[model samples]
Target: MSLEAEIRRLRELDWRELDIKEAGVWPWSLQLICCLLLFLGIFLGMHWYLVSPAKQELQRMREQEVELVREFRSKSLRAANLDTVRGQMEELEARMEALQEMLPTGAEVPSLIDSISEAAIDNQLSIDFIRLRSPSSQEHFIERPFDLQVRGDYHRLASFVADVASLSRIVTLHDFTLEPGSGGVRDLRLSLLARTYSYRHDGGGT
Candidate 1:
């Protein structure tokens, strides 16, 4: 037969002659269950593998940030306290310098003599006499005045003289006298006084 004749015979088949079943709920329900299961599995896998770990890591980072903030606050407080202490120390040092300046400077004989007397009293030494004189014309560095003094007791006089030397003003011991004590111990008498000169700056006298 020809190809056209066969196609025409195939198309002429009756539709009512074919057997077809009605749609049932069982197969549709099974397909719906499979789809639900697939969706649920995807949700659980995402929670376990991705979402849960991300949440935990986020929480850990938040905790670390909080700790870092606390540390920063503590360090800032310490820095502030250090600054305050430094300011106080600077103030104290300035006050000390001011006090040092208030003391006698140069060529002031009375103040130097007073300091020596105080040293003698402090060291339990007896001052026989204190004499102060201006430097002779032949002396070097004549700007500073010259002072002389006499005292008694070996150890006490030595300590007294040392204390006088420790004064901020400049003093020198030019001469001394030693004699035997009542107990045969050597007693020393030192004649010393501090000397300071009139200091002159470019502007004026100091």
Candidate 2:
């Protein structure tokens, strides 16, 4: 058969039998629109409910990691500064120990007399007179010595001065005077010098 004849026969035979529904008219068009809307709704729902929150959580974790790194570096620098100060303190302590070892050992006597007077007052002794005098010069030892004059009843004065000599700071008495009392007893008059030494750390005279 010729091509023109075949075309004519195909066009004439199927006009009514092959007719399909029109896609642009009411029901069919509405169904296609509804399908498109359903797909769009599913995509938007997943993005709002699931994917967006996950992305926000990932960003928060990244920010926290950066802050922690900065804090760690600051703490490390402070630790290094503390170590340097500790080294300097140790050196100063060593120098203080050496100076203390070279100094002479002696007593603080004025402090001892003060302690004795305090004890005598606490013990209810009636002190009539108290005096302190300048120390005597001595060539043998480096010391600052002073004399104490005390007047009281015999027993109270003896006990007070004896207690003063027994103190830890090392006091030595050189002389004392006593007078006779009226009731077959003696009133005490004490004149005694006590000595102590102090060392100068700054190379000044002692």
Candidate 3:
């Protein structure tokens, strides 16, 4: 029908009196309205079920790409500085080894005692005794204690201590007791605690 005829039919018809059971017999105008409504519902359903989830996934992938780019930049910088880092590590290890050499092991204890005896003799102090005590535990090393007794004048005692400190192995002195010799002997009695350190490792001793 012509557009004028269709418009006239729509204007003359009463929509409220339309028969629901006989939809096929409805006017062309009402039928066109129903088709348009059906098409709108299908479009909205397709967008929600298919297109919306795809758009969300694409946004998540874009965010992940950005994080990956940052991670790559950080690793590239570290790789560029790898040689310098390795050099520093080697220097630190060499210094640590030198420090370890200054520490004596269990086998070197006797040699250390001999050195102390020589130092006292060089200072003209008579050696009374040199006694080794049990090792003590410390944080990074073990402490070896020694009890030393000597007979000497005041100046000779000080000189002996200085000689002991000059040894290749590291040693520390503590807890000194000095007494004047009895019966006008003009000699002094010197007693002191000496400590040395040994590196701690997998082996229990040394």
Candidate 4:
């Protein structure tokens, strides 16, 4: 039929006369409208139940992929510099071992004091006293201190300090004091604290 005829038939149809049992006899326009509505409902239902969740899952997976890529790049950069980092670590360890050698062991401290005395004698400084103080425990080493007093000329006293510093073991001088001695005008008395260290082995000072 023509479009105008269909429209006129739909407009002339009776109101409140439609029934399900009489659907087979309904106008063609009504049936077409119902079919279109049914198709639209089915499409909306499918999108809500199936396609929406799948889209959400796909979006989540994409975000996860981005994070994984970032992590991979960071790890790759570290891997590329692995050899250089290892070499630096090894060099540091070697220097640490060398420094540990400079620190004397507990048993060698007496000999270290003897070396100090020899330095004083070599510099023509009179050894007034060279007494050991109580040892102090540190986190990774033991600090052994010596209270030293000597009498000499100014030049000799400076020489003795330099000699003590040049010893094979690490000996640090602290708290130095100088005063006039009773002997003569050029006489000088030197008093100082000398500190030595020993490495702690097996969590104990050696």
For lDDT, the strongest prediction is: 4
lDDT of 1 by residue, 115-164 (tens): 77788888876667765564433222334445445555677877776786
**Highest-scoring model, TM-score:** 4
Clash count for candidate 2 is 0
lDDT of 4 by residue, 86-181 (tens): 999999999999999999998999999999989999998899999998899989999999999999999999999999999999999999999999
Provide the global lDDT of candidate 4 against the true structure: 0.93
Q: What is the C-alpha RMSD of each candidate to the true structure, in Å?
A: 16.7, 18.2, 5.1, 3.8
Predicted candidate 3 versus true structure: per-residue lDDT over 162-187, tens digit per residue: 99998999999999999987625669
Clash pairs detected, candidate 2: none
Residue pairs with backbone overlap in model 1: 107-196, 107-197, 149-191, 171-194
Off by over 4 Å in 4: 1-49
TM-score of 2: 0.37
Which window of 10 residues has the lowest lDDT sum in candidate 3? 197-206
Angstrom error of the Cα, residue 122, model 1: value is 1.1
Over 4 Å off in model 3, which ranges? 1-41, 123-129, 136-142, 149-162, 174-192, 200-202
Q: Weakest 10 consecutive residues, lDDT, candidate 1?
A: 135-144
Candidate 1 TM-score to native? 0.38
* TM-score of every model versus the real structure: 0.38, 0.37, 0.63, 0.75
lDDT at 204 for candidate 2? 48
**Candidate structures ordered by TM-score, highest first:** 4, 3, 1, 2
